[model samples]
Target: MQVLHLSTSDISGGAAIAAYRLHQGLQHLGVTSQMLVGKKSSDDKTVFAPKSNFSKALGILKPTLDCLPLRFYPGCDITRLSLSLEWLPDRLAPKVAQLTPDILNLHWVCGGFLRIETLAKLNQPIVWTLHDMWAFTGGCHYNQDCDRYTSSCGNCPLLQSGNNWDLSHWVWQRKAKAWQNINLTLVTPSHWLAKCANSSSLFQDRRVEVIPNGLDTEQYKPMDKRLARELLNLPQDKQLILFGAIGATSDSRKGFHQLQLALKHLSQSGWQENTDVVVFGSSKPENSIDLGFRTHYLGYFHDDIALALVYSAANVMIVPSTQEAFGQTASESLACGTPVVCFDSTGLKDIVEHERNGYRAKCFSAEDLANGIAWVLQDGERWQHLSRRAREKVEQEFTLELQSYRYSKLYEEILHFGDREGIKSSN
Candidate 1:
């Protein structure tokens, strides 16, 4: 079977990385898989991009072009929320048709890479792997406590618009008109997201399956703590707590503010003297607020080895996100044999077992988050058990091999169903 995976970018963010890993895993399992991305950063030959200079330039400008409609919503806080009305020029359908794959797998295709109208033009069966809430909602990626998407999106909170005949309604109408008859299947990386998708009016009748993102356990496995710290030039005496994301501090959804509050609570509880903080994916801000501990801001890591070493060097990793489709950071930290502490909500609850491999604190409670951190670090013997279980859990459940096998089975079932329908039509 031939599968072509479409994404906005390769290896750029969590979604991109997850998509690329699945592509690689399929190839490893001897399936014919090719990746087509709007922005290609790696040197992989199978990955394709727009060949023309003008098309490449347009691809870079598509995000901005898609967001131009937001200017009408003067009251909107664009920085705090996301909006994508995918109405820009997208010539991907013709290119995708030329490849002539049996199935087209879509992942994170929002930034004007594929227009709503183009879905009708594609002839092949589609398997859309939703990386966020964008596929079901009108335009906002995260609904943020709004259930408008469950019925029909309008008067969007993200757009700060009160009118029912607003931009969100327009986008929703476009989707309802364009995508009503398309042959599509939905896949989500977490049960929480699948539940959300099933409840959404856009995909309420569609088939949705839950599949967690896969990782190369060999690359993310643990290293010697002392040696990793020595290599990273981290102090050997102090305990390190690691926190990071693409925009660690700026993204409201990441809940960095919650983490900061939890750290402060830990400090007040007498853990401050022995602990320090390490962050990646962000440089120290000019007017950095006191985190109540010494902070090391390692700007960004481009490779997995550097990231794996950083994960190895830390005593524990904290992912204090308010909502996540799948907590990739927590999985990576566990693969590195570092215990994780995260809220017992969203996709995180799938990865962290309360005091088993790691700790899952009460949802949105900083005090519980602080207590979780202390519980993981209080005793070396218990910490060793947590660390061992963390690594074993990834090897058993989150490996690329297991993920690829499950996807392969899903693909086969979809193709078989299509064949049976074709036979009935011929009769």
Candidate 2:
């Protein structure tokens, strides 16, 4: 069966990475899969982009143009939240038709890559994998404690607008109207996100499936810790703690502030002298406040080998996010045989077992986060057991082959249902 995966980019962000990995996984399993992205960073021939320079330029500017309607909400917070009304140019449907795939798989297409009207025009069956809350909500990706999306989104907390007729309501109305009759199936990478989708006003009636993101365990597997540290020039005697995300410091949802607090607690409890912190995905900010430990900012390593090395060099990996769709970093750390410490909340709970392979601190509790970190490092014998289990868990459950097989079954089922329906119609 031919499958076309649509994404905003091929390898730029976490969502793109997950989508690309799935595309690769499908190909590995002998499925014909091609990816169509707004921005193509890889040289993969199957990954297509707009050929014309003007269309490419428009693709880059689409997200900014789509947000122009937000100007109507005078009280809105100008944060990095998404407010996709999906009223942009509908150029993708024709391109999709030209490709003529049996199924269309959409992933993170909210950066003005596809329009709401275009979704209704697609002839093929659609499988939309939601990387965040954007697909169901009125378009603040995380929703951040806002339950308005569970019903009809209005008076959006992210928009800081209290009017029922605000921009969020307009977006919600557009989605409700345009997407009502589309042949679509929903997929979420985490059970937490699936639950959220099931409760959402838009997709509550749709079929929602839970599938965790897959990774290449061979690439992410553990390295010799001493050799990794030696290659990176890290001090041999110091204990290293790792923390990062796409926009580690700036993104409030990543809970870097909580990590800082946790590190401070660790410092007071005699970790100050020996422990050092390593951050990826961002450079050290200009005049940044001290994180209460020696800090190393190794800005964004795109190479998987380099990332695996960094993960290997650390004693433990901490992902103190407020919420995550799948917690890719936690999975990667585990695959690298490094114990992960995250809160017992959201998608993270799926990856981290309390005191099993890693530590799951109390939700939103910095003290508990610090305690978990300390607990992981307190005993070398326990750390070895945790590390061993962490790698084994990924090999058993999160490998690309396992993910591909599950998806293959899902795709077969969807196509079989469509074929049966066609037969019924012919009669």
lDDT of 2: 0.87
lDDT of each: 0.87, 0.87
The worst-scoring run of ten residues by lDDT in candidate 2 lies at 418-427
RMSD (Å) of each candidate, 1 decimal: 3.2, 3.3
Could you give candidate 1's per-residue lDDT for residues 92-171 as a string of tens digits? 88889888789889999988898988888988888889988998888988877999999788988887789888999898
Q: List model 2 lDDT by residue over 360-386, tens digit each.
A: 998899999999999999899999999
Model 1 Cα shift for residue 57 (angstroms): 1.2
The residue pairs found clashing in candidate 2 are none
Which residues of candidate 2, in runs, are more than 4 Å off? 419-427
**Model 1 clash tally, residue pairs:** 0
